[model samples]
Every structure is written in structure tokens, then in C-alpha cells.
Target: MGRQEKVTTSLAGTVGEEIGAFLAPVDAALERDYPGDPGTRQPVHTVYVPGDVFGAGTVRSWGDRALAALDEHAPDAAAFAAVLGLDGALAEAVYARVRTKLEREPVEDLRVDFEDGYGSRPDAEEDAAAARAARLIAQAYEDGTAAPYMGIRMKCLEAAVRDRGIRTLDVFLSGLAEAGGLPDGLVLTLPKVTYPEQVTAMVRLLEAFEKARGLAPGRIGFEIQIETSQAVLAADGTATVARLIRAAEGRATGLHYGTFDYSACLGVSAAHQASDHPAADHAKAVMQVAAAGTGVRLSDGSTNVLPVGPTGQVHDAWRLHYGLTRRALARAYYQGWDMHPGHLPTRYAAVFAFYREGFERTAARLARYVHRVGGDVMDEPATAKALSGHLLRGLDCGALDLAEVTGATGLTRAELDGLATPRRGGGAT
Candidate 1:
């Protein structure tokens, strides 16, 4: 027999060069920011305060105010406890937990708003407001009361407000520089971004500010708020979220959804505008796909419904906010905006409940997979990553304790910690 032809099945290249080339920068950017292993504390929610009202003691005051409001709104703790599924004692304890969390980190992230939060004022008034915000920010830093993530939200890059936005940013940053330096994790929120050029221009301005202040380049990160249809879809009808991130050129760290603004842009009536609306769902889906594995964090928008009632009973609104928070969590958008203090209780309730409810099952699956035991269900590496991520998020968010997680996962605290660092590859497509 003729020499048997040696079987030669050469593998094709690992991936198309064009695809690799396209992904190279995004991969690099992901490594640069690496949202999963945030070096700093990541706030569960951000609280926006008007420019003139923001300052050092503001966080503490806000917490105190929130507690007071909670007391008045939920005069019957038992009733509120029933709603949260906590017994009287446990309910009080959870209430205490909320109070403590608020007092300790009332605002994990703060936005000194110069846009909607700070209504249009005269130019001189705006300037003064910016200066006041700067002083307050500096004072908060000095007092160590500032949230881990803190910054200003300037008006949009629309032609009408472009100059004003730039001026506001420059003034606040300049004032911050004069005072000392920007706070750690400081970032600006550029709202209603509709084009890549807008983000690019903002990045250039941020770079200039960094250079002018003698700070390190790329230190001034900004988050893009996708509120308009144009923001998500390019003129050519392609998804623009990735392009928007690229436009930041390493200065972008997050993409936050703006519910009301987005709904309005889509012509949804105020009555129909909501976080759970299909339009919001579509926008969030685009954001997830665009930012996933790119290191740009995603945040859902706030509900306009405040947890307050004319009779000072906030049970109904509290329930609504809790449901909304749970919906966001279900969608895997862990972060959202908090418009009122009453929203705090429901936020924690939903997040903690999610972690706790899944902990046992997730732990069992992880343990079985790790031990190579038969459990009727096979677990893959992705499963391991997901379990680790869920537990780690719970830990990071103050929802689950290290001890509880360690016991459940059959892993040492250190081992679990290792898993917490976002796995490098094989993420969801």
C-alpha cells in the first residue's frame, strides 16, 4: 500500500486578524480600567445634589435627613418590616443597618449637578455656583466625608450649552486644582451624548485640564450618559456605544442610562416613562453589549417617583422603588441613581436579598464543580466565574460577609478573593 497519507488537519488561525485588530484596543482599555476589580470602593448608587447645596457636611446631613424622612414616612416600622419580609426585630435591625450604611457612606458617589439639578442661572450666578461647589468639594475632601466616587455633572454637549458646559468644567476643575487636587475616583458625567465627536471633544478638554493642572494624563475620567436615541445609534445606523468609549480614548470609565431624558427623546409620555419600559430596556441592552468586557461600567437610571406622600407615609413609593431596584438587578445592572433617601432601604433590601437567596445554590454548584463531584449538573469554567462574581459582588456591596461566603463556597477567603478579580477571558458574548 502506498505510504498512508499522514493525516494533516492544521487548525485555522485562532481568530481572524481583522477581528483581533479591532479588539486589541478594546482589550487594552478593558485592562486599563478593569471594572471588576475596582481599586477603590464602588458606590452602589450615586446621589445628585444641586451645585449650591453640595458640600462637606452634605453627605452626613443627607443621611440624617434620609433617616428622618424614613421615620416620618414609615411611622410604623412594623408595617414597613412586613413589606420587606422582616420580622419585627429583624426588621428593626435591617432598618438600623440602612441607617448605619447611610451614615457611614451616605453617598458612595455624588454628582454636583450644574445641569438639570442646577437650573439655568445667569452666567455670573453659574460661575459663583461653580466656585461654591469647588470650595465645598475641597472641604469635603479635607473632612474625608466625600464619597469614594465624586464629581460634577455638567450640561450636555449640545451646541446651545457647549460653551457653558466647558466653562463649568473648567471653573470647577480649576478651583479644585487651586484648592489642592482632585479627589480620588473623581469623574465627570457628560449627559445626553449624541455623537462620538462630542465624547472626543470632552476627552480633549479633560486632557487639557489634566495638563494644565500638572496632574497625570487621563486622570480626569468622564462617564457618558446615554439618553438620546442618537447616542446609542450612529448616523450610519451602527451601534455607537463602543465608538463613544473609544472616543474617550481611555478617559471613559462608565456609561450611565438616563431614563426620563431617554424616554422623552423617544417621545414617550411622562406617564409611560419608566425604568422597566421597553425603550429603557433596549437602551440598557445596547449599553451592556457595547460596554461588556470593555471595562466601562454600566449604571441604570433613577425612577422619578419619590418615596414620599402627603400624609408622610411612604410605603407605596418605597414598594415601587424596591421593585424597580430589583428589576435593575435582574437585568445585571448593579448600579443605579438614587433620587431620595427613602430609596436607600429598598435598594439594600433588594440587593441583599438577591445575594442571600442565591448564595446556597451557587455555593453548592461551585463546590461540586471544584471538587469534580457528580451533582446531576455539570459546571464549566464560566459557571465558576459566574458564581465567584456573584459572591464577590455580594461581598463588595456589603451584602454578604467573607465568612458566610467562605463557608458556603468551601474556599478560603483568599481563594475567594482571587476569584473576585474579574476573570480575564471567556466572558459572555
Candidate 2:
């Protein structure tokens, strides 16, 4: 055999060390600012209930109501498939899981609204409602009937409601603390955040609560609601939404796009205002970029064209909701807002179908990537990670079964998770 050629270097080793030293801060910044997805179960939807109306049975009641909607309108898998134009192969899987999901766990994330959905209540009334919400939610968690995540959407940080928002937040958190400490899935949302200062204020407020309550620092995290035109673009023409995420100081869990309020801000007529609007798309696109790799999830807003009224109207509304949910999923916005109980049937239907339809193709691609084999579509590490992530999300939202993903991909849960997780500095090793 011929001797291996000796490697040669033109530069000294010190040159490499100097380059590393120069880029150390940049590396640290990337690590700090863009930590990637938290690898937690990001819920498919967040259901908002007015504070005055939310009760202990809200979760179960919503489930039952959604199931009833299905029983009335969809009736069966074939009916729903026809309504949403779902492929025949996906009908049974989507239908059975939607039914099972509604029966078992309908609302994955619940937000007790003290903001728009709640409107303005008298100070005393609002205070009592906040406390009541905390008590009820804590009890629900204790009873094992709680959604995976629960919290309040407090009023904005505007001058008129600044004090009210803070007071409500304190009352809710204090109430939970007094009841039996915070639950594992506790969430808080600071709504209508138009400036980075608002985010910093929330961080400070949470810090104060931690200090006062003797809790660990940074134990409380909250979502920043992006619902204003100013939040998407600033006076100086920079992306303020990105600044908002940074201002959260590592405590922001998600960025929720608000449909109605944001549309109204831009003078988008009510008739034309919807989650699929061009204005909403532009704003969410900015949000998607701002939140990318920040470990902050993005949630598309809800639609006011709710599924209600007569059978014909309900069917139309269901189709719209299902299409919107599926559209958001395609755009990589994994979570969304659901305002009406009637919307639940279609929400699950869309999510389940998306996962089911792509199951075979995605599985084959991942298998080929793992085995280093040839296929029509060449898959790389990033593509494999995305494939695994899609499967995990499907499993998380009950859209796809674990046994099926593993059986098809020939990959274990741990292996899938490792691929789904983003490695430092990204790209293939």
C-alpha cells in the first residue's frame, strides 16, 4: 500500500486559537439568544375562556361540547372527511383520534382571559375573578382534570390598566401560592405587548413575586402576546417583536398572535379580518423569525368566524376552521388559539389528518436517512431532525401514535427525541 501523504498547514496553531478567541463572544451570544425549541409538548391549541365564565369543569365541558358537535354535524369519519376534503385513507385515523381526544383530553392549554374576551369589569369584580380563577385552576390540577397548561391573560400594560394588570397578576399568583403552591404547568401571558419595556416589566414583576414568595429566581415564565401593529414594526423600522423576545430575559415561553386586536389596529375591516389575512401573515412571519431558535413557540391567532348556529352554518364554519388550522400547521406555527368550543372538532380533525397523511412519507425519509440509503428524496441531518420533530409533535398532540412512528421508522423514542433536539451551532456534525 502507498504511504499516506503527510498533512501540511500554512498557518501556525496560534492563528486558529486567535480566531477562536475572537469568536468566543459570538458563540456565547448564539447559545444565549438562540437556544432552540425547549423540546416540551407544545399544545396544538390554546382555548380562551372569559374569566367570569371559566369554572372547574370548563375543560371537560368543552370536550363534551366538541364531542356533541361532532355527533351532530360530522356524525362519522366519512362525513367529516367529506366536509374537510380529507383523503379517504386518513378518515378513520383522524376521526377515531378526534373522538378519543375529545373524550379524554379536549383542551390542552387553557387561558382564563381577563383581557378582551373578558372586557372591563369593576375592580372588585375583576379581583375576585382572578382569585377565583387561581383557586379553580389549582383545584383542577389537584383533581387531575386540569389541562396540560393553565394560566391567565392579563390586561395590557397601557396606562389605564397598568395597575389593574399588576394587581390581577399578583392576586392570581398569590391565590395559587396560598392554595397549594403553583402547578407544574402554570403559565402567565402578558397581552398586547407593544414595546420591549413591557416585557422587562413582566420579568421584574415575576422576579418580585419570586423574592416575596421565596421561590427560585426565573421559576415563573410567561408568553408575550403580539397583537399590535407597533409590535411587528417599530418607529425606527426595526422589528420590535424580536426586541420583545429578548427583553423577556429568558422567561418567555411563547409568542401569541392576536387576530382581532391586531387587525383593528391596522384598520382591517371586520369582515375581512381573519387569521389568514395578509396583514396577519406579515405580522406572524415576523414573529416566526423573531422566535426562531429562541425556545419560544409561535401560536397563530383565532378566528371570529366560529362554528355555530344552524347545521349548514356550522358546517361552513367547521370547514373554515379546519382549513385555517391546517394552513397554520403548514406554515410551521404548531399552536393556535381556539375561542369557541364548536371549533374544537375541526381543530383536532385538521391536526390529526396532517400528521396521518404525512406519516408514511416522513417515516420512509427518516428511515432512509438513518440507514444511509438512496431514495427519491435525499435527506440530510437537518431534514431528518425535522422529520423526527414532526413525528414527535404528532405524538404529542395525539395526532399520531407512538407505536406506529417507532414501528415504521425503526427508531426508538429516545432516538427520535435526540434528533428533534437542536444541537449547538446547528447543521450536521
Candidate 3:
């Protein structure tokens, strides 16, 4: 044959250059605003305690109380499993892991409440509580007893409490600076945000705090609590959540659903207020889409029905809470709220069970995809990233052991992460 063509092309070189030039800004925006997940270890749940009740040993106390609840109600793996309908074979493994998780790390994330939980207080009292919260959290971190993430949820940015909210945040961060240094995991929750401007105001306030404290720019980040209809949909009929995220200017860590507040706002009856309520689902569904590819995480709201009272009553509540948690996990809302210490056991149980149940299948698929081996179901790059991500989340939350995943997949943690992150060339993608 005559000399085979060494190269194949359709468009002229100038056409390609012109096209690239035209799309350069679009690429810049994608890289800047939609950089994807930060590959960080996200906590499984957030525990909100009133500012006055939070102390240096609150985390440990919660763990002890949760363990005590288990001892009192469900004395064994079989008993505990019966309440939640866990598989007979998987019950022991899930129960043991839950106990171990409770003993080792009961609360992964904590938020000292100053809004609804703490309620409106006198300025002096609120300021003192805010300052004390900082001191106690600082000591916890110093003593190596702090949760992985801890922060405060100041009052809303409404016109009435705007100044007070700003003051509390300043006092808190300023106190942290005095007490040594702020922890890297320090976060804030802005509650009852009704408009994107409120989010922008939070960004401005953080910028001011950074300048005042001589901290690096953008050092503070906050979660926007979606509790109002206006926050989900604007008067103009636009999805306001997407705009709210943009207003954060790269400082929104998560969009947390406020179950009760949001439900009540939608005129849902008190008895029907729940995270799984249709109203709540619609709100969070909007949030999920708005946050996708924006590096912003989504947190489902909590159930007000706590696990407490007599054994029978506690069992009912546990079943409800556990079922709700499991359902939320199936929908991909990994993080949630824990309102009571009794809720801790079931929360961990649901999470561990979800991950452990799928561990083998996910590992097999990920391995096959990585090795380019034939399989009954063809896997794609996106699916590979998701499979690897599931394993990583499990590993992060102590649901699955590193060695166990490694054994199943024949891949190390770093290799798994490489597979989870897409690259333009010569990588997982």
C-alpha cells in the first residue's frame, strides 16, 4: 500500500485554535466554580447541642450514654438487630462495628446551637455563652477530645437579629484567636437564610473577620440551612439555592436541610413534619441538583421523634430513626442530624450496615473496571468513580477496614482515590 496516513484530521488547525479560544472562559469557570468534590473525609452526621449544654466532655458523654442505652434496651446483637430488622448474618458485624464506633468516636461533627436550640437570649448572656463555647471547644481540641468537626450555628441574619448574629460570630472567632488558634475543622451554620443576599452578607462578614483577626482570606466557611420556601424558590420562580451557593463565593461547605422549619414553612401539619415528607424531599432534591459538581455537600434534616422513654417506646423510636437514616442513605444523602444521644447507635448502625452490605459487590466492580476485565455488566468511568467513592466513604467513616477493601479490590487507598478522581489523560478517566 502507498504510505499510510500518519495523522487523521477533519477540522483545520486554525478552526481548532479559534474554538479553543472561544471556550477558554467556559473552561475557566468550570475549573473555578465546579472543581468537584474536595476529596476530604466528610463526617457522617452532625450533632447539635445548645451552647449552654456543650462542654469539653460532651462527645465522650454522648458515647457513654448511647452505649448505656444499648445495654438497657437491646442487650445483644440479636436484640438490637430485631428492632431494626437487620439481616441475621450481618447483625453481629454491624452491631460490633456500631459499638466500636461509639466507643472510639461517637460524634463526628458537632454544632453548638445559638439559634433555635439555644433560642433568643439577652445580648450579654448570648455573648458569654458564645465566648464560653469557643473556650470549651478550644480545650477539647487541645486535649485531643474534639470531634472531627465542631462549630456554632448563630442566630439568623434577619433584620431583627442581624447585628446580634454578627456579634456572636465575631466574639466566637475572636475568642478562638485568644485561646490559641482556631481548629482547622471549625465551621459555621447560618440558619433561616431566606435570600441569596443573606448568603452574600455571610461571605462579607467572614471577609471582615479575616481582616480583623489577621487570618488568611476565605479562612472561614459556613453551611446554609435551607428552612424557608423563599430559599428554595424565588418570587420570580427561579431555583434560589443555586444562586445562594454562588453568593457564598466559595465558602459554602454544605447545604443543610432544616426538617421542621422547612416543613412548617410549607404548611405541612405538625404530625407530618419529617425529613422524608414530600415537602422536605422536594426542597432537598432541589438542593442536591444545585450542589452537584459545585463541591458543596448536602445534609438531610433530622427527625424530631427522639429515642427515649421506656424500653418499648425507645425501641419504637429507634426503629423509626434507624429506618429514616437507612432510607436517607439509600438516596445518597450521607450526612444527617442527630438530635439525641440515643440516636447515635442507630445512626452508626444504619451507616455501617449500608456500606458493609455493599462492600463486596462495589469492590468487585471497581477492581474489574480498573483491570479492564470483561464482566456481565459493562462499567464506565463515571461508574468507576462512584464505586471507588463508595469504598472511600466507608473507609473514612470506619464502616469498612482499609485492609478489607484492599483485599477485595487488590488496590491501595491511594490507588482507589486515583480511580475516584478523573483525569484528562493517562489516569482513571
lDDT of 2 by residue, 1-429 (tens): 899999988998799899999999998998899888888899999999999999988999999999998888889999988888989988888899999999999999999999988998899999999999999999999999999999999998899999999999999999999999999899999998998998999999999999999999999999999889999999999999999999999999999999999999999998999999999999999999999989999999998887888889999998899999999999999899998999998999888888889899999999988988899997778898899999999999998888999999999999999988957745733
Clashing pairs in 2: none
Candidate 2: regions farther than 4 A off: 426-429
How does each model score on lDDT?
0.79, 0.92, 0.92
After superposing candidate 3, which stretches have Cα over 4 Å from the reference?
Answer: 1-10, 424-429
Pairwise TM-score winner, candidates 2 and 3: 2
Q: Please, what's the RMSD in Å of model 1? A: 4.6
Q: Rank candidates, TM-score, best first.
A: 2, 3, 1
Instruction: Score residue 149 of candidate 3 by CA lDDT.
Output: 97
Off by over 4 Å in 1: 1-41, 75-78, 84-96, 310-313, 371-376, 410-414, 422-429
